[model samples]
Target: MVAVLVIMTAGALLGYFLRKQPKIVMINDKLIMLAVFGLLFLMGVAIGSNPTIIQKLPVLGAQALLIAVVGIAGSVVAGSVVYYFFFHKKY
Candidate 1:
């Protein structure tokens, strides 16, 4: 956990210092996308390798779907409230 925090802090500092560099920002974006894809692939591999997990996937998937739907609904409601209060007023 400490290692993760340290790495995250280091990345944040590096991003702050390099904020003005468009090339570096582009590379960073690509690297982030690649990392996300790699992580997802690894996750799929891990799931595929576990028979018990596979057997439980239907229940897990329904729970995940419920969570995702609730999350999206909450975000939309919260975003609408913020927008109405902060940005939608007539100037």
Candidate 2:
């Protein structure tokens, strides 16, 4: 946990210092994209190789779907309320 926080802080500081350099920013974007793809690929490989996960995939899928539905519904309701209170004209 400490190591993770330290690494995150270091990355934050690096980003802060390098935010002004356009070339570095472009390179950073590509690096981030590559890292995301690599991480996703590794995660897929891990899940594919796990027999326990394969057996529980149906339950996990159902839970994920339910969570996604609830999250979207909540977000829509909250956004509508905010808009009605702050942005909608009373007239």
Q: Rate the local accuracy (lDDT) of all candidates.
A: 0.97, 0.99
Models, CA RMSD each: 3.8, 1.7
Error of 1 at 2 (Å): 2.4
Q: In terms of TM-score, how similar is model 2 to the real structure? A: 0.83
Clashing pairs in 2: none
The regions of model 2 sitting more than 4 angstroms off are none
Q: Name model 1 segments beyond 4 Å from true.
A: 68-91
What value does the lDDT take at residue 81 in candidate 2? 99
Candidate 2 whole-model C-alpha lDDT, 0 to 1:
0.99
Best by lDDT: 2
Write candidate 2's Cα lDDT for 38-87 as tens digits: 99999999999999999999999999999999999999999999999999
